[model samples]
Target: QVFPAHGPGVKAPSLQDGQYVLQGVRALCLRANNTELVSGGSDGSLLCWDVTSGSLGRLVRTVQVWSN
Candidate 1:
């Protein structure tokens, strides 16, 4: 769900990319100042983006989930 950076009132953009390789997103959040974004992918990966600079930051941390 790629939402507009302007505000929550605005609608998110349609998914133009292909199907999600992973099934679910465990968590998603944005900086209170709206200068950054974060999301956790099902494939045990975490992504952080710097909205103001339009660049991806380094991975702060990660957790591996093993299928039972």
Candidate 2:
């Protein structure tokens, strides 16, 4: 979960419906601007999030890195 480092009235990010159930998170990166996030999951999927939005829990983009 992303936590706002220091804000007077920023709300915590909330999850949206129909989101993926990640098996496990292998890697996580917060963008240099601190407005985006990228995560690689064990399911071979990469998810991108908009950290500036309230519904950051729902992925803005998803990509399958590999398939069996």
Candidate 3:
């Protein structure tokens, strides 16, 4: 589960029909400008997406193994 930086609670968006899924999410980090969200998932994948634009930004450069 991912949480906002403010620490209010975990941010879990329901997957409506057409929404993209960031599956197996393990860790989340904000981009340098704080306008985008980067998430590390259990599949050793990282995804970057823009918050305002609602568009995928870039793929993570490195793959990280997430241990359960």
Candidate 4:
């Protein structure tokens, strides 16, 4: 899941057809600056992404903190 850091250009994930299994992850934090997305997940890592590319979940970089 992703959330915008500030005003404007906020969007939600769309449902495709019926009974589709969606991905689950705990996002500890989120920040958006322009088209860039910085997210901290429960997997004990930080990821930078460009949300404008397709699913937009394209990871630009990764920083591992600690894993469970």
Model 3 deviation from native, Cα RMSD in Å: 7.2
The estimated TM-scores of all candidates read 0.52, 0.46, 0.52, 0.34
Clashing pairs in 3: none
Backbone clash pairs for candidate 1 read none
State model 3's lDDT. 0.63
Tens-place lDDT per residue, model 2, 1-68, is: 54443323233222333354425566889979888788765555467777777344545445656657
| Worst lDDT 10-window in candidate 2 | 7-16
- Give stretches of model 4 more than 4 Å off: 1-33, 54-68
lDDT by residue for model 3 over 1-68, one digit each (tens)?
A: 24555444433332333344444566888878989999776456577989888787786665545445
lDDT of 4 by residue, 1-68 (tens): 54454434333332333343332234633454566666554333355666576244644444555547
Candidate 3 residue runs with Cα over 4 Å from true position: 1-22, 62-68
CA RMSD for every model? 8.0, 8.9, 7.2, 9.2
For candidate 1, the 10 contiguous residues with the lowest summed lDDT are 7-16
